[model samples]
Target chain A: MRSVQIPISDETIRSLEVGEPVALSGVMITGRDAAHKWMVDTFIKKTRQPEGDDQQVYAALKPILAGGVIYHCGPVVAGLDTKDYRFVAAGPTTSSREEPYQGDVMRHFNVKGVIGKGGMGPKTLAACQEAPGAYLHAIGGAASLIAQSVKRVLGVHKLDFGVPEAMWVIEVQDFPVVVTMDAHGRSQHAVIEAQSKSALEKLLAA
Target chain B: MQDLTEPILELVRLTSTDLPADVEQALRQAVEREAPGSAARGALETILKNVALSRANSTPICQDTGTPLFYVRHPAGWSTRSLRAQIESAVAQATAHAYLRPNSVDSLSGKNSGNNLGGHYFPTIHFEEVEGEALVIELMLKGGGCENVGAQYSLPHSQLGAGRDLAGVRKVVLDAVHQAQGQGCAPGILGVAIGGDRGSSYYASKEALLRKLDEPNPDESLAALEARLTQEANQLGIGPMGFGGETTVLDAKITHLNRLPASYFVSVSYMCWAYRRRKMVWKDGQVSYS
Candidate 1:
């Protein structure tokens, strides 16, 4: 296992290898399908304008996005009625759902890591190589254990998108993940899929 | 006739925090089956520990408390309208108390109700007028990850070489399991429906999941098929969390439905191991839970 802090540098991300376990710390932003679409649309809109750029649309998120990690999660938050938010359970959602938007989102935001489970596809893998980022696979269904790593809820964005789909800014310590796709262009998901398919055929033959 | 709100709330709490005994036992056996210190074993260990902590702390077993599915059997002359209203109230209370994650969302508007209420079919309730005099409710918290991997096949599948026979059913069902790999949180359970229209097939597939993990299907042939599928899925080497090991699927359940000649649909509902479900029964003015 390796220890990695957030706001990860491209060099650091590039050094990570696929299938290695990691303990992540520092601040990470959370988003799912809705937030990914919102971020990508904002990026496209900003780039199209004469005076606009990626930085302008993402200005507010720049501090958190620059060389940082984006976790694909829909945490169960508490204290909504009191206006004080707490994560009761935090775990990775399936990452394939964001495959279409994640590559561009990483490029636009200069994000160095994407934390999720159920690994993504070719587009995401290419994005990781292009952006020099890594896709970290958190253990699926290990919600309470993962919640233990989240130290605090810093803030939130796009709450109207729904609590599960909203972008939540949080601080974490020793959050566990496996590097399923790394900056060097290797992906455990692709490998596993191929191997499992062959195994299925063999089972059928028997 | 009694106020069922509190009892329903308790049911939600129990379902969210506790792994039913049968599921825990299945997981325990899987742990022993895997090679010691392997990644699959380690993942299962963490999950087992998480289950214990969630129960002790009364926190949700998984972050995605999932879409709450309610199956209710009521005596004649009872009002489903009032029961639904009470269920909605209990679900909201469960959210506020953190027993459930707020999951009700408007699909088009992209707005969360925040209280896990309001949206159409949000806390899905299916009501039946049974011959029994008791009011029985079963709630299953089916999470998003596993739900995403569910598949439906129109039989005579050219791609998979599946025909409109039991062999085709096995082929398609296994294909679904293989495609799921580790994405649906492997060491999962499969609930399969062999026939029905598309929608009804999907519904029956999910309904099949309501059966207990250890319970055998009454149909002898179907029971044997279930056992065989479970064994074959595990042999795929897509162990716990897809990390590779002895167990990919803990159980595979099958239900047969009559279908039209033109449409032979097979639906598969994959469920993660969190498997949060419980039942509550009210009889003779007294309430008890399972």
Candidate 2:
């Protein structure tokens, strides 16, 4: 597995081969359906869109801050009186759930990397190519453990949208992730599914 | 009964937020036994490390936090009192303390459930009476990804065509996984609940998943089927995170009941690589590890 830092370039994006595993360390932004819609509607369609160039937008519900990696995770959170609260379960939800809005989010936000579980669809693959970004698949169901690596809460915003599944700005240190999708439009999830299905058909015929 | 109020509340918080003892052990064991290759192994190792970090840092294990699914095996006399109210109260408290993302939105209007309590949010409790004094509670966190892949089909045994015997059951399962791709976060598990009608089949799948990862199937034929399916599924090279390699499936479980001749229904549920479940037996009005 190769480890790379952020400012994910077009060259790096294009070089990413299908079926290659990569560990990423970089600055990442967080977004989900609501946030994606917000970006697309507000930025793409709107006349004045803020600066978004080569930044990563994690399709995450919650944000973490440590060394500097972004995670595609949505957490279950409960607030105390107003501020103090706890994160119950912090695991990866299926990234495919956001496939419909991911491309637009990436383009609008100028996101370079996406950290999530499962891989995105063809449209997302196309966006990764056009936007010159990457998609990383963090292991699913390992949320509790991932929560530990989060050095600090950093900052938590987006309470009105619901803290756990809403868009939160988080800073993490040395957060871990694997490249399941690259800017070149190659997807590990797609290849494996095809191979496994082919193998199944062969076995069935035999 | 030890005035189960406080203890029940504590258990809810611990199970939902913290990794229980048995679950930790099972997770470590799964990584050791199932994961093969650098990527899968690295992922599993990281997962184990995360578990440790959550314990030390007091963070929830996963963000999904999952909808609480409780399989309660109660003793004969224990049913005299209703435990639903106690459990629900505890769930509410735990959700608050655990900081679980409030996923429950009003189906009709898409409004938040406010307190993780919708039609059956937090703990989806299933009750069964056993011939014993203490109650056995199997607590599992069922994530949405895995839950969505769960499917049910009612078919006559004879309708399974020629290739679809017990072998066909295995084929269909692999196909289901293939169809799901990595959407369910595979390098996962398959639970097949065969026999009975539609509803029972669904319950059976969930129940089968609740069984211990290492435990052998009770029925000899079923156990053999499990072994074969596990091996074959892994051979497909779905790998950890569906990257490709010999670890797509950690295990396959099959549970069947003697069925009526007319129709046989089978249900399949897919679990992500992280299968979160723990069993605690409450006997003699007390809770103990299974």
Candidate 3:
């Protein structure tokens, strides 16, 4: 298994091959449906100016995301009352949900990789091809095991986005993932879909 | 009825943290079928480890502790009004205890309920009055990932040569499994409702998930269909997390309801491998969980 640290270089990211096991160890930001939509609508599309603390939030996020990983996760969190957030259970949410904004988010932020489940669509694969990035597939529902990899909680933003949807900056060690979509424009999900479609047709005929 | 709030809280904890034995067995079997060092096997290994750790540590098995859906069956005189409140209270406690994620959000306001308590639909409690003295409450944590891939089909459709027969049902069901292609988190369990109105069909399909993974359907025809669907779905090669390997679906459950003459709706509910569900039974003035 390959080990990946944060502030990964483009060359390092591009070197990741599809189906290879990777143990990601570093800082990553957790974001989901609401966070993705908020990022796209506010910063990428510039529909509205960053309101209140969002301007500062954006400035803080830019450097971290430049060569970092964005995890598609809505984790079950602990320490809500004390505001000392820790992930009790953190697993990948379905990545396909972010297809609409992932490509643009990657380009805009220079994100080196995405850690998620179920892989992604052509848009993200294309984004990986254009830049040095890969889409890593985490084990779905392996929440507690995955949470064990989180060494510490760095911080969080967007409390208004709900606990799960909040952008949590966490430091992780030996977080496991499979590269399902690579910088070479190969998407394991797409390949499997094509194969499954053929099998479905055969079953229907039979 | 006595206060079921505390009992319901325990139910939520068990459902969230403990992997049912049968589901765990199916996953173990799946791991054996995949080649050594394969991504599919590795995923299953990680899942199993997570399941064990969650149970031992009393943490949620999945981060998306999911929507807490309670199916309540009470004796004739038992009050549903009280049951609903108790269930909600328990759900809130579960969220606070970290057995459940804060899942409910105000659709219009774009705000979370924070405690997993939203409007009526949240902690969705469906109550039915039964003849027995025992009160049974079952909870299924329906995760959003699998819920998104659920499909409904109106039969006698022209597109796939699917008619309003069992054969057509097989075709459409296969189509759903194929389209899911590990997006719903294969190896998945499919709960299929063959006939009913749009609402009941979908409801019954999800209800079918409460059945044990290895239990045979009472209806012979439905049992056969269920077995065949599971077999054919696995053939799709949409293995664990869609990396394309041996197993896709661990089981397929089939249930049927009589429909009006005009409508032939078949609803499919896909459950991810986690498959969190548990029940609490109150009988002889004692409460027990399974």
Q: Go through the candidates in order and give each one's C-alpha lDDT.
A: 0.88, 0.65, 0.91
lDDT at A59 for candidate 1? 70
Give the distance in Å from residue B116's predicted Cα in candidate 3 to where it truly belongs: 1.1
The order of the candidates by TM-score, greatest first, is: 3, 1, 2
Candidate 1, residue B211: lDDT: 92
Assess every candidate by TM-score: 0.95, 0.83, 0.99
Q: Which candidate is the best by lDDT?
A: 3
Off by over 4 Å in 1: A45-57
Candidate order by DockQ, highest to lowest?
Answer: 3, 1, 2
Backbone steric clashes in candidate 1, count: 0
lDDT of 2 by residue, B11-120 (tens): 55555455555445655665775545567677767767766766676566666666778777777766424676667666666666663445666667656665667775
- DockQ, per model, reads 0.72, 0.51, 0.90
Specify the highest-DockQ model's number: 3
- DockQ, structure candidate 3: 0.90
Which TM-score values does chain B get in all models? 0.98, 0.85, 0.98
Instruction: Give a tens-digit lDDT track for model 1, residues A1-206.
Output: 78998889878999999868899999998999987877776664453432334354367677899899999999989888776999989888988999999998888889899998888999989999999899998888889989999999998876777788888999999999888899988988788788889988876665
